[model samples]
Structure formats: C-alpha cells, structure tokens
Target: MFSKIRKAYQLFKSIDFEQLDKLSRKVDLPKVMDSFSKLDEKQLNGLMKMLEGGKPKRELPPINGDFYELHLRLSEEDRALQLKVRDFMEREIRPLVNHYWLRDEFPFEIIPKLAQLNICGLTYEGYGCAGRSSLMEGIIAMEIARVDASVATFFGVQSGLAMGSIYLCGSDAQKQEWLPAMQQMKLIGAFGLTEPEVGSGAAGGLTVTARKTEKGWVLNGQKKWIGNATFADVTVIWAKDVDDGEVKGFLVRKGTPGFEVEKIKGKMALRIVQNGLITLTDCTVDESDRLQHAHSFKDTAKVLQLTRAGVAWMAVGCARGAYENALDYTRKRKQFGKPIASFQLIQNHLVEMLSNLTAMQTLVYRLSELQDADMLRDEHASLAKVFCTLRTRDIVSQAREVMGGNGILLEYDVARFLADAEAIYSYEGTKEINSLIVGRSITGFSAFV
Candidate 1:
C-alpha cells in the first residue's frame, strides 16, 4: 500500500499541466480532473503514465458510442454492414444534417451515397433486399439517428413503413414492381396513415373514403404528418372503403389528379424530413394498385409493429448522441477555477445519463433479439418504445443540464438532440398510447378509449 501511494505521488508530481492543457483540448478536462481526483496514489501513477508521455503499466483506449459493445455480438456480415452505414452517416449525413435541418430541407444530393450502402428495404426477403435480421436494421436506424434524426425518420418511412407495407401486404406482382427499384433507392416511397383528425386513433377511425368506380377507385381524404409525401414517387394511402367500410391500402402514385401534397411547416423536430399534408379529392387508382393482403386495420398494425421498434432504437441513438456530446463538453468546460466535471453534481448527472442510456441500450438490444426470433408483439414493441423514448427525454434533458447554457445552442449539438427527442416522444405512438398497449397486455384492460 505504501509503495502504491509512493508511486501515485511520483506520478502526480510528474504530471505536466502544459501537456495536459494541450491534450485537454483533445479530451474532456473536467472528466480528466474528475478521474484524477478519484484516483488513489497507485491509480494516479497509472494515469500519469498515459498522460505524461511515460510508458504506462496499463493504458485505456478512447470511449465510443457503443457502450455495450453491440458490434461484438453481431454476425460478421451484419457488423460490417453496421460500420458501412455508420461511415455513410458520419461522412455524408453529419456534415449537412444540421444545415438542412435548420432550413427545413432535404439534401437530395446525398441519396446516391446512401444508395451505395445497399441498406434500403432491409429485412425483406427478396426484390434485391439484403434480407438481414431485424437487429441489423435497428442498429442501422440507431447509427443514422445518432447523427441526425430527420434522416433516420426519412429512412424509416421508406424502409420500414412504406416498403414494409408492400413487402408484407402487396401481392407478389406488386412486390416485383416496386421493391427492386425502392431497394436501389431509384424510387422513393411514403406511407400515408395518419389523417388530420385521426392521429393515433387512425386504426379504427379513418375518415378517408375510397369509393369503387367504373373507372377504378376514387380516394377522397387528407393525410397529415405524412413523411416523404411531398416528393415521393409513390405513397401507400390507407382509407376506409365506402362499400364495405373496411380499411384498405392503396398505392397512390404521384401526380395523380386530385392528389396534392403541401409541405407541413413550423416543425421544430425532424425539420429536414419533408412531412406533407396530403389531400386526396377524387384521386383515382387502378384496382391493381390496391395492396391485396391489406383486408383491414390489422395489416397496417403489422407495419407499425416493425417500425415502432425501430423508433425505440432511434430514441436510444438520440439519447446516446446527447450523452456523448454532453460528456465531451463537460470535460472541457471549466468552472470554479477547475473543470466543472470535478464537481460532484456534474458527475452525478453524467452517471444518471449513462445509466439511462445503458438501460435503453440493453432493452433495445433484447427487443431486437425478440424481433429476430419472430416473437415480437405489439406489447413488446410498445414497451420498448415507451421505456426508451421516456428515458431518452430524461437523458437528453440531463445532458443539457450538465452543459449549462451551451446545451441550448445548436452549434453545441446537444440542443438539436434535446429538441428532436420531443418529436420522437410524441410520434409513432405517444407514451400514454404505448403504455396503454402494455397495459392491455399485462392487465387485460384497454385504457385507450
């Protein structure tokens, strides 16, 4: 013990503040100070070995976004795909994400690079799909969202909702017609489910009416919060049949007469995604465009079941993004003549954020596993969606708290995450709605009226 103490004292004595200040520019000073303060003599010596340009007995590598080492558990092919997607997100998306997000525009230029990843329509069996597991798809969602939520939402609508609708419900001929091009990103698709008045109650209360006509089917209604609708080549519009009153899905091609899309404005979150308010007034579709397997709302629920889990993964990504940024900021930011990270309260905030982030990571990991096993249910997806999004709200808020005023600034990165978390919390299904799903499963009582 005495030798350990002596070594620690020697290590501290050798620490060069000048060197530390230079390296501090690269790392978090507050975090270093906090770690330094907590170290006993022996630990201090070990840290000094790394910090003071000495040959150390032990060395610790840099921290990364994957705190739970998720990549390690993935199959080699899936792991490679994850990295490829991450690189694309960081290189192509990250640089322009904030600018497009601020201007409320999509960067159409990056589509080609994104297409090169060959990740579109992931988890589908054929039509040029990679046919990967749900776990890989969820991880890709996280990777994209960790950089930008808008891009992730855009991808989700296309890959999980729009294409998934066709993949799961369309006839083989319909799949052959759309999936290949969509998989190549040659054709963009959108899913139109929520109506202006319906929102979460869309399943049972669709006001959009589809009337059978001698020519074909005429769709008349409005869809609100429809992602990618403004510029999509095709949209899957869910409407109730006028004759049978059964909810049916239609592939409404763009430029169809009476189908108009007006971009929704004033969105503070997911600003880069071109959400559209679509009005269908006597919009006609061929009988062939109807999704044959979509007999009722039950079919739509299947698409949501797949994407809701991805939303939970996106929530985890958002929380992780905020936590990492906050952690990086707190270590560099100084207060009270030392790094603020040296303060107990700041460390407490970080620990809390990490704990929530870690819990979310573990939960989503297992959630994806269940999805891969074909055991995913509405309640299972809802539990993850509710838990992760709620905890993400808390995590991002605490992340902002630790960063002080800088947390609110967009340039700092945490502010955008904080703002984006709000939209994620409400979209897909509200926390209350999702909780009710779990509530119904466990308690056998439906709380949603």
Candidate 2:
C-alpha cells in the first residue's frame, strides 16, 4: 500500500503545476485529479503522453528584415556564418555605436574579439582568409551595416578596398608579407584614392603625382576622406604616374617620411570611421612597394569594381535597420488611444519602406551572384549601387516619417540612419556617377561629363 501511495505521489509531483492551475480555472481540478488517480501505471503513462501531445509545439520566431526569406538561398554553412556574424553585431556593435558615433571615436577595443570571428578578407583565397563566395561576403557586409554604418564602412575599407587592392594587384611577395596579418586584424589598412579635388573623377584624374627614380617612387599629393588612415598600419595611395600619366598604386607604410595624415573632423555621418586627410609631400616608397600589377587606371578600377558591390550591400543594411527599428517603435508608441501602427497612413509608410528595402536586398543578391560567377561588370555593380543607395534614401526617409518626432532623436536610431544614408548615397560612387556608368553600359553613350 505504501509503495503504491509513493508511486502515486511521484506521479502527482511530475504534474505541470501552472498547467494544472490553468485547467482548474476552466474545469473541476479535484474531479479531474480523482479520475486521474484511478488510472494504473500503464494507463497513467499513456494519459501523460496524451496530455503532453495536446500541448502545442513551440515555434521559432521568423528572422526579421529578410522579408523575402532570401536567407533560405544560402548554403547551410554560409547561413550559419551569416547568423554568427549577425549575433556578434547585435551583441557587440549595436549597443555601443551611438556612444562612439557621438564621441566620433572608433572602439579599438573590439578589434580582438572581431578578429576572433575570422571573417576579414572573407572572399580572398589563402593568406589566412576563408576564401568564401562573394555572395557570402555581401551578406556579411549587410549584417555589419545593419548594426552601424561606420563599422561597415571601416570594414569595407579594410576588407574590400585595402585588402582587395593587395589581393588583386599586389605581387606574391606583397601578398605574403601583408595579407595574413591583415586578415587576422593585427595590421589595419586604409585606401587613399579620393583627393580633395578629385572626388567623382578618381580614375584618370588623380592629381597625386608619383615620380619614379633610381631610389624608388616619390608620392606627392593629398588624399582626402581616406577611411582608417588615422591609425592604419598601411595606406594604399593611388597616384598619377608623372612620366606615363597613368594611375598606379603604392603601399605607403605608416610613419613614412612626408606621409602625414591628419584626422578629418566635424563629420556629420560615419563619425566613428576616423577618416583622414593624407598629405604625401615627397613621400618616397621603394620600387618594390609599388603594386606590381597596377599599371594603369584600369587596374585601379579593378579594385573599385570589387568594392562597389559591398557599398551597395551596406546601403541595404542601413535602410533595413532603420525600417525595423521604426516598425518596432510604431507598435509600442500609442496615438489616438491605440498603436500608431494601426493607422492606414502609418501602414502606407511602413509598406513603402519595406518594399524598397526588399527590392534593395533582392537586387544586391543578384549583384553578388554575378560577382561570384566572375561575370560582374563595373556597370552591374554600379547599377546595384545606384539603385540600392537611392532606394535607401527613400526608405530611410519614410522610416523617419513614420516615427514622428522621435525619429529625429538619436536614441531612436533612425535619425542616425537618416544621416548615414546621405553619406552612403555619395560614397563608392555618387548616384549620378553610378547612373552614368550604367547608362554608358546599356546605351553605348557616355553621359558622364
């Protein structure tokens, strides 16, 4: 009798108390328990299993911002890496961005942890890189920008612009000397191609002059708005050859004589990027320091071609982040005794933002596909850049509009997006420039003056 009693006690102890309490509110628990107690061991086990089966299976919430479920297209490994990067960005970069942006400082402390992720130089082969697909790299760019545009820009300069210059144009010796440490994040890099006067016409118009002599190449000119230059270990400087009038690249090491970098101040957007105004007055680089394969502006364009797609991806991320935050804010912010999200006009703004964001995401996905297939033309990436950044401006504007007055506040996050979108619109290539690139491609006419 005692053994049976103990067994019954054990079974009763295993009951879900909260569920029982819920059942008690709707039914007579005492009667239910009395009936339940009469079941023998086998019957009780079956009954428990039946009760468990009646409960609903827990469903996972859908991933936000992937409105078209595009992530399902990624390979399993690629998807896992994407999620890992997303998790890191959410946990490490998101919370700290506004503070750094306000201070206009880079969180140099995050480098070690970020380096541990082993994501830098993601699409490059060997030299400690993952050698992943261009599509995966684009996805990573999107994830980083979704947290902070400055972080994404900084990473783009390092991974796409700086490292890509080396990978595509560097000699085997240069690649062996630089890429491994850079891929590990132990050595930071910068790309100096834009001049104070040569913004849109960087290809054939670089005024920075490089004179080749017996000693080496002497770089003389200024590069403005160079990201990561303030503290980068290496800065890739593009200059017009004094003799040939062709463009060439030089790896200008830090603290090289006459290579002076002054931090660009008073930036309204991408404040944490640490952009620099580089003044290279008779900066002498060894003959060996020149990019072996970069013989002309076309070679330099190859580097730009690789990075333009990343810029487009970053624009998409910025727009998506703003839309997601605005959507969440609307659901919680009350107006007219209900959520603002319930209003028709508010829905219109959200739909516009979402539709644009969705379009940007899909377009970049195809752009990256072209890149992975090695069929990506300059115009293809330019079209994506032109389309994504232009749509991002519209989407971010709608996101700000829906959030009302709170949208302008930095704490709300969309205001940052609002300002950052303007910068992204002009970077890599401006809308007019990119549009002209696409125009020349399809129509066989140069629209760019």
Worst 10 residues of 2 by lDDT: 54-63
- Per-residue accuracy of model 2 over 403-430 as CA lDDT, tens digit each: 8899899998999999999899998888
In each prediction, how many residue pairs overlap at the backbone (N, C-alpha, C within less than 3 A)?
Answer: 3, 0
| lDDT, candidate 1, 1-449, per-residue tens | 56555554565465598876777689885675555566686667666667677764444335476777867898888888888887888788778877888899999998777888889988999899989888989999998888888888999999999999999999999999999999999999999999889988987899999998999999998999999999999999999998998999999998999999999999988888999999999999999999999999999999999899999999998988898888888777988787787799998998889889888988999999999999999999999999999999999999999998888888888889999999999889988889999999999888888
- For candidate 2, list the clashing residue pairs, or say none: none
Q: lDDT of candidate 1 vs native? A: 0.89
Deviating ranges (above 4 Å) for candidate 1: 1-61
Q: Rate the local accuracy (lDDT) of all candidates.
A: 0.89, 0.91
